[model samples]
Target: EDQVTQSPEALRLQEGESSSLNCSYTVSGLRGLFWYRQDPGKGPEFLFTLYSAGEEKEKERLKATLTKKESFLHITAPKPEDSATYLCAVQAGGDSGYSTLTFGKGTMLLVSP
Candidate 1:
């Protein structure tokens, strides 16, 4: 079975604070690791796609890095506008056709001014 676990389920930070969220997983025939940011009552917006160990991607204030068994989402100098739920998902082999993402619950962040 494929599984993902995210730590520090909820975080509270002041403006200019920096922190990193963790996502650990177990998958068979690992295909891809994806990171997304989702707002309350909204769908997730893609952030990065990592296909192999040591892969990384970054955008704005967020950086995502992948390893053999886990992935990390690093947030730098976050502002209130950057507060959101960060999600990590992994794609592994499926029973048929196309594979699907096994997503972690998510890490909710609140940045205060």
Candidate 2:
């Protein structure tokens, strides 16, 4: 079975503090790694997609990097508005277009000004 786990269920950061969250995954024939951000009451918003090891993607204050067994999301000089839950999911090898994503519970980030 495919599985994803995130460390530090919750994080508290000062307005300009930078940090990185860990996402560990175990799956057979990993196809893709995806990063997403979710607000309190809204659905997760897509952030990045990593198809192979050594790949990285970035946007705004966030950067996501992928490896063979895990992914990292680095938040740089985050702002108060960056407070939200960060989710990591994986697409495993199987039926290409019909595979469902397996998501971690997510790490909740709280930024204080």
Candidate 3:
């Protein structure tokens, strides 16, 4: 089975504070690692895609890195608008499509000004 688990279900940050969240996964064969950010009442917005070990992608104030068994999302100097749910998913062989992505519940981030 393919699965993804995220740590620290929730986090609170002051304006400009930065931190990293973890995502662990188990897949038959890794295809890609995806990072998404979702605000309340909306679908996830794509952030980064990591395809292999030692690969990384970044956008805005966020960076995502992948390893053999896990991936990390690092936030740098986040602002109030950056407060949202961060999700990590993996694309692997599944019955759904070419490769189905399994997603973690999410890590909720709240930033206060």
Candidate 4:
């Protein structure tokens, strides 16, 4: 089984402020880790995919990093439009040649202008 944990269930930041969200996980035979963003009443939008430690990906004001045990999502100079819930999910392989995504609760960020 795979488990994931995210810290600071909610975050409030002023426009232009910078902060980071954390996601820690435990999994067997990890295939990939994924980052996503979701808005109220909407499905999650894909952000990044990290396959190995020391890997990174960026888009707009967001940057994602991965390590052996965890992942971090850094938001730089965010704007009001950036407010959303950030999600972390991991895909792991099982004995039956199947893979499933184990997700964390997510960190909700509110950026104020």
Candidate 5:
């Protein structure tokens, strides 16, 4: 079975502090790794999709990197607006010609100004 684990269930950071969130995953065959940011009471917003090892994507203050077994979301100089629940999910290849996502519990980031 595919599985995902996100470290540090919650993180507290100062307004200008920088940090990285880890997403470790295990799958029989990896199709893609996805990153998302979700605010309370709202659905998750798409951040990035990494298809291969060494691939990376960035938007504003967030950067995502993927490896064979894990992915990382790097937040540089965060602000209170950046406080959100960061989610990680993995798509696994299957014989049915479809893919399904297995998600982690997510990391709740709270940035205080």
Candidate 6:
């Protein structure tokens, strides 16, 4: 079965604190792994697209990486404004030539000032 699981469910960090979040997945075939940030009352904001194992992408204070079985989002010197729900989604590549996303529950982050 293809599925995604994110750990820690929720995280609390102080301003300037750094941490790494994990996303575990199981799938028959992987097309891509995606990372997103969702703010309250809004849709998820795209963060990164990892095409294969060992590939990584980064933004302001975030970095995302992928492997054969899982992906990771690393936060560096986080700020209060960085607080949000981090989501992990997977695109399954079957014979259809296209794919659909299977999303994880998400990791809610709280950064205290």
Candidate 4 runs further than 4 Å off: none
lDDT tens digits by residue: candidate 6, 18-63: 9999999997789889999999999999999998999989999999
CA lDDT, candidate 4, residue 86: 94
| Residue pairs with backbone overlap in model 1 | none
Pick the winner on lDDT between candidates 3 and 6: 6
> Model 5, range 61-112, lDDT digits (tens) per residue?
9999998989999999999999999999999997785898899999999999
Q: Write the per-residue lDDT of candidate 4 for residues 27-107, one digit (tens) a residue.
A: 999899999999999999999999999999999999999999999999999999999999999999978878889999999
The number of residue pairs in model 1 that clash at the backbone is 0
Backbone clashes for every candidate come to: 0, 0, 0, 0, 0, 0
RMSD, one per candidate, in order: 0.9, 1.3, 1.4, 0.6, 0.7, 0.9
Give the TM-score (vs. native) of candidate 3: 0.94
Report the lDDT of model 6 for residue 38: 99
- lDDT (Cα atoms) of all candidates against the true structure: 0.94, 0.93, 0.91, 0.95, 0.95, 0.93
| Residue pairs in candidate 6 whose N, alpha carbon or C atoms collide under 3 angstroms | none
Local accuracy of candidate 2 as per-residue lDDT tens digits, 8-76: 899999999999999999998888999999999999999999999999999999999999999999999
Which residue pairs in candidate 2 have backbone atoms (N, alpha carbon, C) closer than 3 angstroms, thus clashing? none
| Whole-structure CA lDDT of model 4 | 0.95
Candidate 3 lDDT by residue in tens digits, 14-48: 98889999999999778898999999999999998
